[model samples]
Target: MKFVDEASIKVEAGDGGNGCVSFRRERAIPFGGPDGGDGGDGGSVFAVADPNLNTLADFRFTRVFRAQRGDNGSGANCRGASGHDVDIPMPLGSMLFDIATSEKIGELTRSGQRIKIAQGGFHGLGNVRFKSSTNRAPRRASPGSPGEQRELRVELSLMADVGLLGLPNAGKSTLLAAVSAARPKIADYPFTTLYPQPGVVAVGPFKSFVMVDVPGLIEGAAEGAGLGIRFLKHLSRTRLLLHLVDLMPPDQAPLAQQIRTIQDELRAFSSEVAQREQWLVFNKCDLIPADEIEAVVAAVLGDLDWHGRHFVISAVTRAGCEALCAQAMRWIESQAPRSEQDLMDDEISAAAAAAPDAEAGDEDHRPA
Candidate 1:
């Protein structure tokens, strides 16, 4: 439960309740005028989403929240009590930014949703609401309204449909622990999967998808280098991008220059993630050498000049891992009805037909 994904918090919202004044008298009634009362309407923070939360680590160490302060008016008119709203929860995707003008302010991503943010404070006004007739001993009242702080930040991401990419120990946690149910933390060394890690796989009888693994990405990972650019916003909601590679590399370079240095750090982190729809696998292949498996898969696909689809699996002896998980569930059921900008234009035309000669730069790995 030490995942975290990101946080910041502050919130606050709930502070209106203060308007009594009083003035009724008794013993039959001496002049009974403005009975005052009227104040109570504060308490709103919200946030929700909670699919049993995945982890923001409970906002780290409880980063201030607030909400609940109304109640305060009773005199003979009575009318207070309305605060209790806080909510918060989070998890299912999160996002909500705003920490001083970063704006965005929304994005729970389903699982109950909710939102609000902070806005509760407006309930003051008593003295029988300024009863008049030339001011009948009024004496006004009002004094409450003040709740709506903020700061926020959140930022989870994780939603998936496949998005492994590679570089360090390019086995993507042994192909998401050999096809889903996620256990992660496999190690042969090299950044043994640090964060992200979702799973779900299945492909029939109620078909499934979600994949994500994320973590290992180097060569100036989108600019902050190793584990930076915060796991590239969990691969911008992924849609497909396996990538892997390591066609046998104890680091003797040349698996086509380590697949062109992970396709030049994924087009230097974001040419729409180097034009998604990746797919290329070729993982451990049982560490190559079975009579040089067809000459190391034909010299690593002719020096990484790769063409289109490619597989070779081995995620720890599941060789050809079920036809690379049945051809990645048939290209995620044929791009599950496209649109994510046509699956990022079919992953930048399959990364320009698998690195046509590389170089499709322009940078902007998103997530400023």
Candidate 2:
């Protein structure tokens, strides 16, 4: 049940059965012709997305997967039994890649979705197939073909409607815990939440949106600082981003500069992600002096050249949290239903296109 987001594995398809070479021998017939049957085809390897799964921990222990080999052909023109296929179950939002070629195989975004990772070998031909008028009672038979083998990298990204972005201890976990059933580890210290946590935020009856709390981002996060570039790719699928800023930080690095630092990191990560719809959220309002709250908000807005929607809330007290959730739900509901598969495909294609550059140490942040 441990949360494992990434894993590597090798898969091998089943080998086809060998063909039989035989001729009929009957008392009534003087000369018998070739009557051997063809061999059975090998089994294939497939990966299936299951909604019940939320992690890739299952792949951690088992790194090698191989399908069953087909049975050998029998005498008297009897075909061999086909091999059983191997199915690997993974969580929804799993992305598969070819490690050697760096090719994007596919992404699983919906329940029951499946993709063939390796193809089975073809069955061998029997002597009966080689029999003809030119050569009667042929004794020729073809050997079975070998199955396909591949080394793959599997990574999981949690699917959500809204993503929380901010520096460490910006109250993202508290917000998620307050609004939904997800119970993330909470502490006053930074980096308390190491992994992504998902929750269902309900707006009304039959109206809800998923929210994801990603790990904290440091100033040089795009350059592999802090938690490194491991979890940033999870933000690509989010429709809206909530940029949380601590209004009153004990460290006293100008609040405006802190906001800018996060913005710079976002821009450095990906321009496409930077241009996504983002709302400025000033958190920890309760700690801010009553008279200085407005001044601080105005100063931060001016520093960022603000002309967009913003909010001020305290995640611990649940102050303004409801409104924030409401607004998030409204924005999510307004946007078109972006196909999860299409988005994942785009990400994979982008990664594949940048593989060469990545190999050359191109400082590009890609999902591991």
Candidate 3:
């Protein structure tokens, strides 16, 4: 199935039923008061997260969704039945927004998570509700209000543990294929990957991580120059980013310059994303002699002033891939969940640190 990450849709909730007005008549009784029933409430619209679905293709053609309308009230004190609610199955990690106002509606990050998109209209009041001792046999009946309607925009961001970042033909697809079972299109030309592809890399039984490969970026990608601009948001959810650089390139661009180009584009797109935890991986090492690999790595790191983790590997030959994967697994495992007490301690420490500065500022503002 073709992967669709974004879609526009319209949702409407059901309308409430109207109230009824009637009078009771019998041979034995001389007069009977109003005997009308109130209308039932309308149904609402909801969006449900489905873990089995990864694409928004289901909503591509069907753009409108509506819930069932409520039944009308009847005489003889018969209340109308409520309308049935409607559920929209959406892919996990879906974020919904109001297209008209550009306001965020909600997000579905976990499986079976649901959020209400539109509220149903309120039911009308019956004539019996307005009855009073002073004025009996009232003939008034209220009409139901209209339902809520909205135009929504839904976007999907894949949930992955690690993400790959690089320029076109940087051996990102090659590296992913070597480590995992994902078979992204591999070729000698650039831009082989057009979409985001995810794969599972397992270090041991019941121990594994999900890695995602997105389309390569270009110098002007942040300005919508390449496909990466469209898919870069997919990496926002990842915990780690692997920046792959090609050791041997068809073009004679400086290795450091190539890396800088991607860095500039990333910062331009999102500074927060650029500041994320990233590791450098120099690929295609088999092309260079074993003795010279260290010198090349050192020079590149020196030129870029890189201080984080670095790795040398040949995706084609699978050399140094195991060590990289193992280290990645260990690092991922190290990011354990913090306890509630730890969070509370951190908050207290932050507040205490701020109190002194706040007092010093107040003293400066005070009159002598």
Per-residue alpha-carbon lDDT of candidate 1 for residues 1-368, written as tens digits (9 for 90 to 100): 65788889898999999888889998898889988899899999989898987888877779998999998897898989889998988888888888898998889888988999899999887899988899987987998899899888888988887788777887888788887788988755566577888888886688778888877776667778777668777887887787887776667777667667777877776678677778677787676577876677778788767787888778887778777777878877876666689779989999888774443342344344
Ranking by lDDT: 3, 2, 1
- Estimate the TM-score of every prediction: 0.42, 0.89, 0.90
lDDT of residue 223 for candidate 3: 90
lDDT at 211, model 1: 85
In candidate 2, what are the lDDT values of residues 1-368, reduced to their tens digit? 55688999999999998888999999999788888888888999999999888999878789999998887776678888888999999999999999999999999987899899999988887898898899998888887898999999999988889999888888889989989999999977655468999999988999899999999898888999988768888888788999988887768899888888888988888899889999999899999687988888998788779888899999899999999999888887778676999799999999999988777775455456
lDDT score of residue 303 within candidate 3: 97
lDDT of 3 by residue, 91-148 (tens): 8889999999999999999889989999987887778878999879899988777778
Those runs of model 3 whose alpha carbons end farther than 4 Å from true positions after fitting are: 339-368
Write down the lDDT of every candidate, Cα atoms only.
0.81, 0.88, 0.89
What is the Cα-based TM-score of model 2?
A: 0.89
User: Considering summed lDDT, which 10 consecutive residues are worst modelled in model 1?
Assistant: 357-366
Question: Best candidate per lDDT, number?
Answer: 3
